[model samples]
Target chain A: MPKSINPAIRDFLDGRIWLRLHTPFTIEDINQQIEAGHIEIIQGIESKLVFMNRKSYTCNRCENTDQSKFTIFNCAKCEASCAYCRNCIKMGRVASCTELIVWKGEQPIYPTSHTLAWEGTLTPRQQQASDDLTRSQEINRSHLIYAVCGSGKTEILFPPIFHLLKQGKRVCIAAPRVDVILELEPRLRVAFPQTEIESLYGGAKPTMKASQLVLATTHQLYRFQHAFDAIFVDEADAFPYKADETLQKAVRKAVKPTKPIHFVTATPSDKLLVEAKSTGGISIINRRYHGHDLPTPAYISLWKYEHHIQKGRLPKKLTDWTNERIKKSEPFLIFFHHIGFMEKAEPLFQLIHPGIHSVHAAHPDRKTYVQALRDKAIPGLLTTTILERGITIQNVQVAVIGAEQRIFDKAALIQIGGRVGRSSAFPTGDFTLFHNGITYAMDEAKSEILKLNKGGGTNPDELPFM
Target chain B: MNCLLCEQPKQSSPSWQSLIAIEKSTLICEDCSNQFKRVDIIEVGDNIDSITSIFTYNEAMRNYLHQYKFLQDIALAGVFSNELKQALSKKKAIIVPIPMHPTKKIERTFAQVDELLKAADVSFEDLLIKTNQEVMGEKTREERLSMSRLFQIKPQVEIESTTYILVDDIYTTGTTMQHAALTLKEAGAKTVHAVTLIRAASEQ
Candidate 1:
């Protein structure tokens, strides 16, 4: 005979589809749950994740061919031959007999009538796009918001998300990058103070409790299956997420098989747009909420900037740019292409101005340094494209040291420019590219910004007051 | 050939000088192998005469063992075979494995310690059979202490009064090894020595 489960536990475990239970739960309690059929133990740590016959093998997660990654061995725990997936082995080996308790019982219903606490108003373009998203969400159909950089895409997502939350539908706002989640989490929490929200990323401590709204990275979506009623993919066209097929599949797998998926991005690849437009309606927001134009970038040649930085000497124009920003007491972000050059250039720029710092994706102090910049404790930061998105500083100036590098694709360049003029108080900033030679990507980035401006933007000349 | 962990090609210095420093059957490159902290504490208490373990079970070794044992990357059994062999008795002796019960063997599929010996090409007898089917992991330390008689010599197995070299994977608290050594000694083996690949390093 099985005992009735606590409702709190059910709500917490439901959307967590597949999760590992290590210490804290007594084995007797686990056995009782197993008897109750609330969750079936798939495989314990002793068992292999994939059970294979001699002829063929398959991975249940990611669904890749079991080649070099899956190696078979006579397992002592299961007393049988088994294979394991090497691809996701880093995420804790899923061998045969590995104990994976899955949520197999009824999911929790979270009906709420609370209205959104966000008092800010959206622009007419943002309002129209939000309405379109609401219709798409109602019909459980996919939609894409093809907004340009600095076009207030995050704010536009608020109304539709609020509508779904009131109707008791589970909503997930997934981003390809962790930095984006960090940037959006506080704002979303502020907007929906009455809603239970959870933010998840690689190192984030997962709040196992049931949440009406979830913010997660696409990589974190692997542990989720048929979880969300509506999934919104922010920065949908970012690197790895756009290039990697597995992450794309994870987004699809995360939501209920038939539910809606919305993608919000400033720069959408042609293939993504074409595919999305075929199945869903598309809306575009090309102007920033303040009706200001995207910053127009001008390129200047610095033929041997690398040599100059390594020799502890910066080019005169670059030095003058740094000094000018320092003199004006304005915060700035200088984008670098290569990590080695970025490191070498950091100290040189510090000599130019000791108040400056540098950061990269792998830096141990990246989060702290970014926070320092946000608090106005640092005058400027020398960083890689890691800061090109997810960071908004007041009246921050932008410059790309090696804009001609292959790493600075048109989309990345657009994002780098988008870093400027985000706050209404600082609706204008200098967007410059210091390049060895003008490349097609640089021109394409510039033309894209110009195109967005031509679509719908206040005349830059008339914004002199800003 | 490349280092298995870092995948860097093995760098060779002047030939003769490097050859003497390099051990034959060394699978990982020199720098990668250097990361494992070699332990000086080989033997524990009086019950076990002599023991040899290669690496201190530090965080790195813990992670490596986690991948090998729990992750079941059975291929790693080959990675440490040579190192494990050098730590074992060189003299002629019967290699006896600390057997897991049928229940545990069914769950894990392969006995981790036995696989380590097999990869080293050390001839061993799987004669020590586990009598208890209870899991050590789910029990308290007191329950584990009560499990002193969990293993026994297989029936009809001839005890030749010869040397016995017992094999196991980890030596945590020395309980599991003590049980195996005492079993072999009482069964009329002249001498009993044990070899473990990693021993638990006291926490900092």
Candidate 2:
């Protein structure tokens, strides 16, 4: 092994963390690096026998220890019954015989001379939260920014991120949903114009550049290992991340062991709130940056709205609401709990205004449809909870079709209502919850908004802002 | 029981046929099996006498192969094991699985053709060895047609004066089968027949 490392190998692997053995790089180059002690290989899956000689396999990358998600097959390569992790198989198959390579070469030197090109000024509340975040990073402490939706959460991250980058520290902002990452990429790129930013998601093109800042979905973090100095999880309580423990483990695995994971979200769960309070690292901003009250959802009863929609009829109250938004040429978003119901109601909504479209998680045109609404090229969209967060459409009226459904929990309903009145240009809009019957979740969501509007959750030190 | 392909529980309903015949555990559900379009098409090649395919290379079959082979989900090989068993049971010929290159076999972890035959509980012999590691899937039809000898009989294998059946996962241009059939025929086999899980629809 030579003391001098190959530059090509270093460039390909610098901050990539861990990559599968079968990568884009040539085998000869990788072999040379391995011989030079500039690269180390880790077994993709490790196995050990448990009780009664039942073998248990754990994915080295995702740390998935669940026995059900592991499957064994007679492997010709290893000549044994090798186990692979099904949980993270979509990234690539990580079997017991497979190898993952990480760079042990000299680290790339990052430029400390960088600029924060954000031209906008933060409000007093935002500045205080931003200072709190920056100070926490200076002391190497975890912090939570409990800001309301549309409270300029992304802007609050800029100063702290720039401060870290000034010290040649790598940072990653991971979100649970791809939508949040997609929304944050362009904004972060604009804020730090000189820095190399890599945005990684499921289908994103692989990049070999050594980036100082990374914006990726939490699912994408499974490929990264001890890569970031500071990792901030945006929308930390969102779906899959909140419910799936593996994603939380991925976030913890992605950052350096000595560093901390900061969480930024509008609606913090009681568990998150209590943890942050014990550490004295929580900052709450009750008001939106536009200085407008959060839109409290107004409930309207539409008994058997499903039957009318299935029977090719629109309920009267819903029709009137759509007609008003159509007449005023205001864009609207009607959330549905189920994709099937939203699809059935699509044509009826389109009949009222032919340009209305429906979108869901798997919709091919979901990205384009959201773009169309932002461009004002369409009337509105009927979507599932996928659009509950990480979207801002000015003057767009919002409604939820099945508010009583179990899918619309307190956090979900709050995020949905936060979609309204986002832009300062039109800081107030109608937020209606059309339901067959009002449930406890709906009432709780409405009252939570009222409480936040009355400055109930603001930081105690900043009570004067109320 | 769960479907081998989709991993969903099989919907079982007792019928008159269930009472009379021994119950065989359903390996695939109706929904997953229904997606595959079966085409019992047979094509006669110059060297290989005939190539019989059980299914067409439709979108569903493509995804099935991707999961079974590329993604290395070995349980999916049993998805069509029953059909393969029924088809191969009556044949009087010796079964030979198309061999993969040793390196490629090591990389893929399992021989897909051998696994397909093993899942059906049909015994097979590896009579031929792949000479080259070039993936036929990456090459065009013209390139494949022009490609040279890819298979050769194993050194110690004896080719008897009896019928031989060649089994492969897919029949693309009939090039690999033709090469293997030519190898076996040159080794003194009486006749060669091919069976593939899927026959790729001819490119226009």
- Using DockQ as the measure, the top candidate is 2
Candidate 2 lDDT: 0.86
Q: In candidate 1, how many Å is residue A431 off?
A: 3.5
Q: Chain A of candidate 1: what's the TM-score? A: 0.90
Candidate 2 lDDT score at position A58: 86
- Report the lDDT tens digits of candidate 1 across residue range B1-204: 555454456774556645685544555677667778978466855467787777787766876787777766676777787677776647688888888887776655678878888888787898888888875557777777777577788999877787887778876666677787778778887888777777785322
Error of 1 at A381 (Å): 3.1
lDDT of 2 by residue, A199-271 (tens): 9998898667778899999998888888889999998889889988899999988898889899999888778
lDDT of each: 0.77, 0.86
Docking class of 2: medium
Worst 10 residues of 2 chain A by lDDT: A457-466
Q: After superposition, how far is residue A267 of candidate 1 from its true place, in Å?
A: 1.7
